[model samples]
Target: MAIEIKNTQENFWSSDFGKEYTDRNSRDTRDWDKFYLDTYGVTKTTINEKILGNLPKDAKILEVGCNTGMQLVGLQKMGFTNLYGVELQPYAVEQAKKYTQNINIIQGSGFELPFKDNYFDLVCTNGVLIHIAPENHHGFMSEIVRCSKKYITGFEYFIEGDVESVNYRGNEGFLWKADFCSIYKKTFPNLDVIQKDFYPYITDKNLIDCMFLLEKK
Candidate 1:
């Protein structure tokens, strides 16, 4: 029988498996300071200079799996006023609220977003989509695109073709890699790739990811 992926994901992220992450991040052990994505080295400065330039200071942005709200905090500091985040894990949501400001943190799943259509100027995920099962990708993608008025972004592990399973802390099928760019391009014909960049993870040299920025036509 197929595993209930949502239940499995909820269990993994709400417990110590997820708490440890938020805890570590709070203590400065996780380097998610500023608009720079920790461990992976993707930064707002770098991204603005390279791919997406001239982001409005007051644009509405939402992060799909904003674990500890670090990225949201970073964006606020960078001058973005209206910011929002949705996190499935309760502990993470609590921690994010405790730490960040000017951002609405909601406890919800990506498959069924609670926001209205074209609500956010930019909608994104940082290393979050990899955890979703392939079958559920269509569901999540549709909601992400629907909520975003102009831009959709994914900074995630790159898989050229098929879904590849990742072994995480003795867990199997919890993580998978896919070419997010290809998937987005194929899914929405009106969306055009604005920028694409790749780099290796600092924590683990073997792990690599691609940052994709797509503009809705």
Candidate 2:
């Protein structure tokens, strides 16, 4: 049975718009390597090594809004055996299952993750939080914090000040950028920063993306 999506942003991602996104973003491992290299001047492997290499290969990792599971594929290639993903769109979940091996991909919502509290060693999101509306940010962050037993990590558009919405492909109120790490830190003080870096868009340096790993204290 499909869960009822209550949030407007959640509905948007579970609709045709989200399926279109899934179609456009169904990249394999090689494609992701090139994308990270081109966009961030580093490969996904290097980024994962920097942020997660220290953890054991059996570490349980969950990526919220995993799209088609390319990121989990990357982790799998790195020898991580326990990889899981939760995505809002059923199409994306199906695509992920088709492409990946030994990975658990499920259709679900980030707002109400189906996992128990502190169930995963690392909970992550990539370019996901920006799509959530500002009014629901706290609830979303709380879920991430609740599900993460040790670390919470993500990569997102970064701004120093208030939340700012950006028009995404002519759609309004569906994308936003802000200091997401600061919000997590302020909201859950038990989380301590483990690793942080900013990668600017190769074409426009003004547009920056930030990634961080935070450990629950």
TM-score of 2: 0.97
| Candidate 2 residue lDDT tens string, 1-217 | 8867978998888889999999998887788898888888898788878888899999999999998998889989999999999998998988887789899999888889999999999999999999989888889999999999999999899999999989999999999999899989988899998888888888677799988899999
lDDT of each: 0.79, 0.90
lDDT of 1 by residue, 1-217 (tens): 2123365666777678888877765633235444256665666556544544578878888999898787677667666788899888778888876778778998888877888999999999988889877777788899999999999988899967787889877888679888988888898898999888887778888777888899999
The residue pairs in collision within model 2 are none
Runs of candidate 1 with Cα error greater than 4 angstroms are: 1-7, 27-30, 33-45
The local lDDT score (0 to 100) that residue 74 gets in candidate 2 is: 90
| Residue-level lDDT for 81 in candidate 1 | 88
